[model samples]
Structures are given as C-alpha cells and as structure tokens.
Target: MRIGILLHALFYALVLWKGSQASPYWMGLLLGSGAGFYWYGYNLLSLRETDTKLRGEFGSWTGMLSSLATMAAPLLSGFLIASVREIGYPLVFSLSLAFFAWAFLISQRLVTNEESELPAPIFCRRHPNWNRVLLGNFFQGIREGVFVFFASIMVVMATGSEWALGKFTAVNALFSTVSFFAVGKLLRWYWYNESMLIGSFVSTGAIALFLFGQNYRTIMLYGIITAIFTPFFLVPFAARVFHVIDEAHERYEREYVVEREIVLNGGRVLSIIAFISTYRFLPREWIATYLLLVGSMQILAVLILRNVGFRLKKSF
Candidate 1:
C-alpha cells in the first residue's frame, strides 16, 4: 500500500506536469485514467498475496491504515499546490513522493520477524459471495466518479472561480473525514446494512437536490447532506468485506481476503474515461442531472444484494 501511494504521488506529478505542457483537460484525464487502471491491477496482485498470510482483522487494519494515508493525500496536495508557486505541480508531487517513501521506511521498521513465520496458505475454491463484494465496491467507484464529474462543473458554473473549486473540495474532504469517525461509532452501535440503506436514500435525495442548485450556497448545502450520508454508504462496504474475510478465515486457517482495491480503482478509471468522452458535449445542468441518474443506480444494487441474502455481518 505504501508503495502504491508512492507510485500514485509520482504518477500524478508526472501526469500533471506533462498535462500542463499539453494543457488539454481531456488529455490529462486520459493519462490519469490509464495510470489508475494499472494501479487497480497492481493492488489486486499485492493484496492477493497479503490475504494468504494475515488474519482477517489484521488484514483489515493494514488496509484501513493505508486508506487513512490515501484520505490525507488531497489535503497534502492542496497545501503543496497552494504554497509552492514557482515549481508548484512537480514540487508538490515530489513532496508527496517523499512522504510516501518515509511511510514505507517506517512500515518496514515496524515489521516483526514473526510476520514471515506463517506457513503458506492452501487455496480455497472461489466463492460466489466474491461477486457481491465486487459489485458493492464497483458502485462506490461509480459513485465517486459521477460525483466529481458533475460537482466540479457545478462549482465552476456557480462560483466562477477555480479557488472555489479548491474550497468546496476541501469542504467535501472535511465532511468526509468527520463522517468517517462518526460512522465508525454509528456502526458499532447500529445495524450495518440498515445504516447503509439509510445512507443510500439520503445520498439519492441529496443528488436530486444538486440538480436544483444554481449557486454556491445550494451546492454547499448539498455537500452537507452528502456529508451526513456518504460515510454510511462507504464504511459498511468495508465492514462487509471484512465480514467476508472473517468468514473465510474461519474455514481456512490461512485465509486469503481478496482485495477489491483493484476493481474499485479500475471502475473509477473507466468512469473517468466515460466522463471525459461524454462530458464535453453535455450541458452543465445536464451533467448535474446525469449525476443524479448515476446515483440512482445504487438503489438497484441494494435491492439485488438484499434479495440474494447478502446481509451485513460485521463481527465487531
């Protein structure tokens, strides 16, 4: 995971610098999409190996920590872009790379000799439940892509400032961060699937409101609504995956918790491509409406998963 972040920091920097040289938005997105796809594949390979050696909760802890770093990347990037004007993009990326490298070094030092003492895992036959895991995670990718594609245009149209872009994005990030901890506690006390269902309903309603918004105030209001519900939608998905890992571990001593990090990022890469391919011809209002349309798809996913008896089953 540390290596992945290091690669991401370096990758984005190069893409941005080269994109600036060409200065075309679609071109930049194309480069980013390709890199994202490759990252998806790489994460799958790495996580597959880790799955065999680690217990479910232990695997989840590592994944959660890696995600913590991923969450902080944008804030760090924003500071870099804001502070370093002379060698801005590249320098920002370079700093990100340095941070990731330091993290990797720290992770290495923390590894215990016992980590390598575990025997190799005996493979289990593929499980049908894996498909559901993939589906749930894939929609999350679609959700993120759809949100970014449309909301960015709306912010630009409403405020007419790139700076507003940074501010609202920061706002969204902050909201998501707060929701992460809040939802963690919520899950501890409440039903996992129920919270997610409620979140899905709120998200759908909020996106619908986004279609009606025409100014910063409405957009921020919509953002707040998203803040309330978005974590519910996401956190349960991780919890569900952990449930699967736990179940697998119960039957197979050396359990392999298949990581969907690859598929999730791959879906995002595809969504970005789809966004770039179609966004130019679409009006801003239509983009907002399209986002609402995309969000609605989650309702179908929820129904399908429930019908198939994929109930929430978190151990803790």
Candidate 2:
C-alpha cells in the first residue's frame, strides 16, 4: 500500500510538472497508460514469483488499506491546488514529490515477512473468470476517467472558475471519507455486486439532474450522490476480487492475485486512455452532453448486469 502511494504521488507530481510546460492532457494520459501496460505485461509473465511474495508479504489486507489512499488523493490534491494557486503548478509538483518521499521512507521501514520460502502452485490461467475481471476493470477505468476528465470542465462551465472545481472536489472527498465508513457497515446487509448495481443506479439518477441544473447545486448534489454510493460500488468489487485471489492461492498454492491485479490495473489504464483520447476531441459544450450520456450508460450497466445473471441472490 505504501509503495503504491509513493508511486501514485510521483505520477501525479510528474503530471503537474509536465502540465506546466503546456503539455497536452493526452500526453499525460499516454505516459500513464504506457507505464501501466509495461507493468501489467511484466506482472502477467511473472505471476508465480510476484504472488508468492505478495501472499507472504502483504495478502488481501494490502488492498483494503490501499483503498484509503484513493480517497486521500483528490482531497490532498484539492487542498494543494487551492493553497498553492499562487506559487503555481511547479510548487504543487514539488509538494507531491515531498509526499512521495515521505511515503517511500515509511514503506522502507516495514519489516518483511519470512513465511514465504517456497514457490506456489499456478492456477488455471484460462478460467473464464479472468475475462470477466478484465472486462469489469476496463469499464471501471472508463467510468473513472470519464468522470474525472470532464468533471472540472463541467464545473467551470457552470460556475466559471477553477476554484469552484476545487471546492467541488473537496466536497466529494469528504463524502468519500464518509462513504468509506458507511460501506463497511452496508456490506453486512448487502451482497457486493448488489451494492455496486444499486450504487450505480443511485449515481445515475443524481447525474440525470445535471441536464436541468446550472448552479453549484448541480455539482454539490452530484458530489453527495457519488460520495454516498462510490464506496458501495467500488470497495465491494475490490474485496471480492481479492477474495477470489485468496481462494485461488489456497487451492493452487500459487500467488496469482497481485499479477492478476496488475493486469487489471493495466486494462484500467488503457480504458482511461481510450476515454480521454476520444473525449478530448469533443467540443467544450459536449462535456455536459457526455456527462448525461455516461449517466445513461451507468443505467445500461445495471440492466446488463441483471440480464447476464449477475444480479445478487441471497445466499449463506
């Protein structure tokens, strides 16, 4: 988890630095996507060795703790961008660099586990489950990139200020923080997929109001709705993926989970790149239009899940 945060902080710092040079957003996307693909491909070939280490060193809880970092990113970024608006982008990059350094040092201090002296057995790579995980990851990436790429544009168009977008992001972060706790409780009552499907529908409904709303209210409502449901949708899918990996590791004695996760993250990066590449070409007014279109797509995801026999059924 610490290593991942260090890497993320570095990545964002580079983006801020590069953006100062007037580099196109597409370039940042390309860099991120290229790095992800290279990492994913390497992990795929080294699944056995990677998993063996991860199982002995980190295990499933690494994923749960890592999730908190996701919530922290936008929150920290929002505050930094706001406070450092005077010093400008370079300062922001430097600040992010400091964060990376601190996180890296913390990761180095952690002790290594010694239980993993032997190689694990490899599982069936051909399982249909891998395809489902991959596709789900792709769509999840698409959803994330689309929301991030246009959200600021939409806020600025509606509110006419970058500062407004910062406030909106901060609000969403607060909501995300709250949702993290809320979801831990919600899981006791709902199945993981069911939580995701319901949250998607809830978020879709909130987004639909943007077609009529023009004030900060639109963004605030969107943030609140997304905050309420994102963890519900996101955390469970993550936990279940790790659950499957743990089960596989137990049965096969091979640690394929981390490698599989890396592949999934790579797929996610490609999906984001594709979305950003296409969306960047659209006219500015189309930003709001695409938000509406994405909301409809979320609705469609719900329907697709239902028809494909993925709807949650109560089971012990």
Candidate 3:
C-alpha cells in the first residue's frame, strides 16, 4: 500500500513537472497501475481485518468517508481553479502529491504479522459460488465504468459549467453519506438480498428520468436518486463478497481478490469499448438506450447472486 501511494505521488510529481508535455496515455497508465496496487493491497488488508458480522459497518464508514472526500475535493479544486487561474491546476496536483505522501507515511505505521503465501494460479478452477461472486462483481463493474465517467460528463454538458457539476456532485455526495449512515444502522444480514433488489430496481429506474430531457434538472434528479440507493446495493454487495471469501477459506483469500479485480476490470473495459462503439457508429439518439442497458446491470448482478443462493443469516 505504501509503495502504491509512493507511486501515485511520483505520478503527480511527473505531471506537475511536465505539465502539458506529459503524454496522457502514459500518465493514465501510471495512475491506473498505482490504483491497481493500492486497491489490491487495501482489499487484502480489509479482508484480514474485517469479518462478515462487522463488514457492513466497515463498508458504511468507508463509503461515508469517501463521499465526504468526493464532496470536498471537487469544491476545493473548483475554488482553487477559479481563484488562481494561472497556477490552479499545478497547485491541485501538488496538493494531491502531498496528500499521497502523507498517506504513505501513515501506512508505514500499519503493522501486519500475517504470513504471505503463493496464491493458486489464476486459471485453477474454483468453487461454483466463488465464480458466481466474480460474475456479480463483473456486472457491478460494468455499471460503474459507464456511469462514473458518463454521468459526470453529462452533468457538465447539461449545466455548461464545471462549477455547477461540482455543486451537483456535492449534493449527491451529501445524500450518499446520509444513505450510508442509515444503511449502517438499519441493515441486517438477512436483509442483504432484499436491500440489493430494491436498490437495483430504483437505481435502474432512475436512469429513465433522462428520457424526459437531458437538462440539468433531470440529471440532478437522476444523480440524487442513484446516490440515495447505491449504498443500499453496494454495502450489502461488499459484505456478501467478503462472506464468500470467508467461505472459500482463509488461504485462498488473496487468490479471490486477484480474480475479482481481473473480472471487474474486464467488465469495465468491455463496457467502455461498447460505449465508444455505440457513440461512434450509431445515432446520437441511441445513447440513452445504451445508458439504459448499462444502468440495469446491477439487477443482473443481484440476480446472479440470488441464483447462487447467498447465505443469509437471521443474526449477525
């Protein structure tokens, strides 16, 4: 994790020094690799530290903090850019590097005595349920890949201002934070499937609001609705994944993490390619249809999990 953060810091430093001369492809490669390392290590550590009983709470707090950061970072960046036009981007990049360095330093204090072992080869056959979990993760990633970038771009296009998009995202984050808090308090082990079902349906349905118009109001409504329900889906989904990891046995946890990442990224790449193809080779009006197709992916994930008969306990 520290190495990942150091790499992230290095990436920022290179961008800060090179500015526009930097190749976007190489910069993205560096950033993506750093993210891969960070998330892999983070997920392993989280699995080691959390159990099924408490995983929901852990996910909730993590989501809440992430939402807070999402809310603050945009507003801060926008303020800095507006206030200092000449040096704004560089300043933001520098601040990001400093924060990464701080995170690296903080990570150094973490003490883990667990011994590492070689994970089974990626192609080795796994339990049926494990494969289903990976499939669910893949579908989840498909929705995320399209929605994360496309939704934000649409908001900016609709509002004709980055500032408006930032405010919109901030409001969405606030709603998500509240939703996470409520889910943390109210969610129970037996409710996981039901929560995911409701969240998936509502979130998927919210995408239809775009059919009304691609204006700011419709987009904002969509964002708010998705934000409020996403936690309901995501928190349970995460807990269920970890629960499956536990079922697979402690030794295979690392293997499952690697497999999960690969499958998730594969889905993301496929979705992005599909989106690009649709945009380039199809009519503009087809975009909404594409969004609707991808938006329903969460329901697919829920159905996959349901088919696998995920263990639901009466008590946590």
Candidate 4:
C-alpha cells in the first residue's frame, strides 16, 4: 500500500508537471496509471485481512486522516503558485512525493497479517445485492472524479488566483475531516444506510443550489457543504461493502475487493475523459455542467442504494 501510494504521488506529480509543459496526452496516461495502481496498491499489495483488520468503521478513520493531511496540499500549492509562480506545482508535487515516501517507510515497520485457514470459494457469481452497492459507488465515483479534476480549475476560473482555490479546498477539507469523524461515530450508533441517505439528500440539495452560483464565494460555500455531507455516503457505503462481502462470504472477500476497485476506477476514467474532452468547449458553464452531472449522479446513487436487499446492521 505504501509503495503504491508513493508511486501514485509521484505519477500524479508528473501529470501535474505535464500540465505546464502542454503535454495533455502524457498527463492523461500518467493520471490513469496512477489511479489504477493506487487501487491495486491499497487493496491488494498492502492489505492484510485479519480479525481486527476488517472490524469497525475503519474507512472513517482513514478518510478523516486523509482529508486532514490533504487540506494542506491546496493551501501550500496556492501559496507556492502565488510566490514562485511556474515552479510552485512541481514543488508541491515533490513535497507530496516526499510525504508518501515517509509513509512507506513507516508502513514497512507495521506488523504483517497473521496466518489463517483459507475458506473455499462457494459463490462464483456476483451477488445481486452487492451489485447494487457497487453500482452506486461507481456513479458516485464519476461525480467525485470530475469534481476533483476540475474544482481547482473552476476556482481559478472564477478568481484568477491559485490562493483562492487553495482556500476553498482547505475549508472543504476541514469540513470533510470533521464530518467524517462525526458521521463515523453516528454510523456506529445508528444505521449506516440512514447516514448514507441523509448525506445524499443534503448533498443533492446543495448541488442544486450550486448550479445558480456564479462567484467564487458561492462555489466555495457549495464545496464546504458538499464536503460536510460527503462522508455520509462515503463512510456508510464503505462499511456496507465490508458488511456484504465479509459477512456474506468470507472466501470471496478478495473478489469483491477487486470488483469494488473496478467499479471505482471505471467511473473515474469515464468522468475524467468526459471532462477533459469537454473542458475547452464549455468554457463559461463547464463548472455548472459538471456540478449538474455530479448532482444528477448522486441522485441516481440514492435510487440505486434503494435497491439494495440486505438490511445494514445498526451498530458496530
């Protein structure tokens, strides 16, 4: 996992570096590789499933920590872009590369997974129930990928400065971190789907409001609200993935893990391509268009989750 993350950080930095060099194709290839390897690295190469490994709302802790760390990136990038101008992005990416390398070093010292008896595969077909969750996750990924790819650009378009983009993202990260922790605790005490539904509903309303926004302030506000509600779907959905896959069939745990990554990466690739293709054409309203797409997909996700057959456990 650490190596994968380190590689992703490096590749992602390379892609961003290409942005300045006018190498769009190279940037796309690097971006795709980074995303693909990130999945393999996190779930396959680094993961060790033990009794404690699969227990509790593990996604929440990671999500919050990730957001907390990530909040600094945009802020620092904004500062660097403002101060050093053209060299800022490279510096930012280089810093990211260093951070992940440190993480890799630390992870090397962690205990390895304990040996356990492997269960025989009983089911080869994907569960109808599991499919619904993956469907929702995929659509959500599309919305999220596009937003991440274009959000800073949107801020830059509106404000003409990287600092504004940085501030907006920093606040969004703050909200996400807090929301993840709060919603994580809430999910442990209440039904996971309930939090997921509430988050989806609120995020839908905020996205609707965002469509009418024209300035950086309103857009920043939308980002904050969206961040706050994001973990509602994210944390719960993650928990449900463990619930369905681990509880349903221990033997096929690894299969579902792969399937989840496929759905996520598929959506990411589709959305990024869509945005990159249309970025030039939809100059004035591109933000609105993608925001609408995100809102629309999120609504679709809500509908898809409704079709899920299993009742989520109420507590951790």
* Index of the highest-lDDT prediction: 3
Global local distance difference test of model 4: 0.70
Q: Clashes in model 4: which pairs?
A: none
Q: lDDT of candidate 1 vs native? A: 0.59
Q: What TM-score against the true fold does each predicted structure earn?
A: 0.68, 0.66, 0.96, 0.81
Residues 86-187, candidate 2, lDDT per residue (tens digit)? 765566577767876776686566554455466554434554554455455545554664675556666877877656776676667666766666666446
Worst 10 residues of 3 by lDDT: 307-316
Quick one: how many clashes does candidate 3 have? 0
Q: Which ranges of candidate 2 are over 4 A from the true structure? A: 1-19, 22-88, 113-124, 213-215, 249-289, 292-316
* Candidate No. with top TM-score: 3
Q: Give the TM-score of candidate 3.
A: 0.96
Q: What are the Cα lDDT values of the candidates?
A: 0.59, 0.56, 0.88, 0.70
Q: What C-alpha lDDT, on a 0 to 100 scale, does residue 25 get in candidate 1?
A: 64
Which scores higher on TM-score, 2 or 4? 4
Regions of model 3 farther than 4 Å from truth: 114-116, 309-315
Clashing pairs in model 1, backbone N/Cα/C closer than 3 A: none
In TM-score terms, candidate 2 sits at 0.66
Where is model 4 poorest over a 10-residue stretch in terms of lDDT? 45-54
Worst 10 residues of 1 by lDDT: 51-60
Ranking by lDDT: 3, 4, 1, 2
How big is the positional error of residue 270 in model 3, measured in Å on the Cα after superposition?
0.3
TM-score, prediction 4: 0.81
Q: List the residue pairs that clash in candidate 3.
A: none
